[model samples]
Target: MKLVQFWRNGRPALGLQTERGVVDAAAEATRLGVTVPEDMAAAIALPAGELERLLTPLLQDPQCFTGAPLAPVVTGTDRIFCIGLNYRQHAKECGLPIPPAPVLFNKFSNALAAHGDCVKLIPDYKKYDYEAELVSVIGKPARNVSEEDALDYVFGYTCGNDLSTRDLQFARGGQWVLSKTFDGFAPVGPCLVPAGELDPNHLDISSTVNGEVRQSSNTSDMIFPLAQIIADLSHHFTLMPGDLIFTGTPQGVMHGYPADQKSWLKPGDWVEVTIQGIGTLRTTFC
Candidate 1:
């Protein structure tokens, strides 16, 4: 089942994207006199198969919802962790050695942006770039889990663009957090697919600027897959439901290109990040 969050009655509400349409889970539950989780976070915490059981009735209904604006697929997450150079090709392009372990960074909740939202670019930064990524959403609390069993704790996966300002990122002794956590920098969604439904490490991921493709590669290129990332992270900090892990991006970022061939993103550019099985997430630069 595809899960989504949408604005209704001036607030974020849980939604289920089905063949019929995006159903307002809360509204449907109320109409049917059934109880259900209120939002994505609550839904994620539901016992195994419970969410599906509760929403099955709503999915069978014929009614379809339309005209509501989408919110970020996952919200109120305690931590937003990102992996750097997890893609071998990306690291090769940048001429950096592949890290021995997953390199971690972070973004705050303020960086979250929904599908179709317009992202405002900082006027002073001229090296804005897009990194198409596969995001793993944790479903349950996991601490000191082994790599073999890491994926069992995943709630689902979604498409994400790790929008960055190369100038800020590599300047002043490397201000990674400041460069990466800008408001609207992490645009994720379109919809979230339960982990059981898709293979996170084998999906095709790509990014397009305007109408042209920029990054095109598969998750198979990842140097450290999602399972390892989860296990590695769980060893240090407990992985909680709703916490997002951006598994890094493939090659083809503008920063990876030769100086003479580089073309940075600017105002009026529309960016889309697509991951196989999930969907495309669109963001406009203004």
Candidate 2:
């Protein structure tokens, strides 16, 4: 089942993309007098098979969610972990060597933006870039998990755009956190596909700017695949339900272009990140 979060009144509400249409889970659950998760975080924490049991009935009378806008697929996540240079071709384009391990970084909740939301470009930064990536959403607590069992902890996958400002990223001897984590920097969604529905390590991921394709590659190109990344990260810290792991981007970023050919994103641009089976996440810049 494809899951989503959308705005209802002033708060975020749970939604499900079903065969009938987008079902406002919260509303349907209320109408049917059924207790269901209120949002994505709550839904992720539901015991194994619980979500299906609770939501399956609601799907029968799908009340197509319309008019109201979509929110980020996840909003209450505790951590947003990001991997850098995990793609071999992307690393080669940046002139960096393949890393011995996954390069990890993080973004805060404030950076989360929904599909179709307009992201304001920081005027001080001249090199805004787009990174289309696959995001893994954790379903349960995980620590010291082995690569063999890493995927078991994942709940689902979503499309993400790791928006970056190159100048701020490379300035001051590398302020990765500052370069990343800006408000609305991490726009992910459209819908979250349950892990069992798709293979996490073998998806087509790509990015486009104002309708022009910029990056095109598959998750198979990732140097540190999802399993290894989860296992490696779990060894260091506990992965909680709703925690997001941005698996990294493929080749064809503005920073990878030769000096004269570089074209940074500007105001009034539309950027999109698409992952196979997971749908597209579109962001507008202003």
Candidate 3:
């Protein structure tokens, strides 16, 4: 089921996308006096099969929602785990050798913006770059998970842009935090598709900047696939529901271009990150 959040009468509510029209889950539940999940987190945490069945009647109603509007699937994510150099091509583009393990990094929740939200270009950094990645959403508590079963803990997937400030990223000691976690840097969620719907190995993922394709590849090329990433990460800390893990980007970032030919993202530049079977996440720079 394609789940979303949309505004109904100026209040944020959950939606279940169906053939008739998007079902305003929260609205219908309230009208029926049925208990509605408190927030997106709770809604997702609810036993999906049972919850879906309970809401099926309302979900089939055409008048359950107002006009379809924008809403992020969930708000206030607890953690944003980002992987770096997990794609062999992306590693080579930066003139670096393939890593021995998944290169892990992080972005604060402050970096998250919904699809259609504007990413503010930090005026000082003219060399902004985009990295299209597959974002994994954790659905259950996980600690010390094995690579074999790690994927079982995942809830779904989404598309993300790991927007980077190249200068700050490479300058000084090359710490990625300041360069990559600028406010509104991560725009996700046209939809968060259930993992059951996709095969992580063969999906097509692409990134387009201002209508021009800049990055295109398949998950088959990932150096550290989802299961390994989950297992490795779990060895250190517990992976909780609502924590988003960006699996890493493919090659063709602007920073990978020849120095003389490089061009950074500017105001009004639009970016779309599309993962086959998942959904496209589009955002504009301000």
Ranking by lDDT: 1, 2, 3
What is the Cα-based lDDT of residue 241 in candidate 1? 91
In candidate 1, what are the lDDT values of residues 1-286, reduced to their tens digit? 8999998776677998876778888778888889988889888989989988988888876364756999999988758999999999999999999999999999999999999999999798899999999999999999999999999999999999999999999999999889999999999898999889999888999889987999999999999999999999999989899999999999999999999999999999999999999989999999
lDDT at residue 225 of model 2 (Cα atoms): 91
lDDT of candidate model 1 versus the reference: 0.91
Please give the lDDT score at residue 184 for candidate 1.
Answer: 95
Candidate models: Cα lDDT each: 0.91, 0.91, 0.83
| Residue range 148-228, candidate 2, lDDT tens digits | 999999999999999999999999999998898989999999899888899987899988898999999999999999999
- The top-ranked prediction according to TM-score is 1
Instruction: Note the clash tally of each candidate.
Output: 0, 0, 0
Q: Candidate 3, residues 1-286: lDDT per residue as tens digits?
A: 6776675566557776666766777667788877766556876687746556766666554466645675666566859999999888888888999888888889988888777888889688788999998988898899999999998888888888899999899899996988889998887877777777787878899999889999999999999999999999999999998899989999999988998989789999999999998778999988
User: Residue 101's C-alpha lDDT in candidate 1?
Assistant: 96
> What's the distance in Å from true for residue 64, model 2?
5.0
- Cα-based TM-score, every candidate: 0.97, 0.96, 0.92
Q: How close is each model in CA RMSD to the real structure?
A: 1.2, 1.4, 2.1
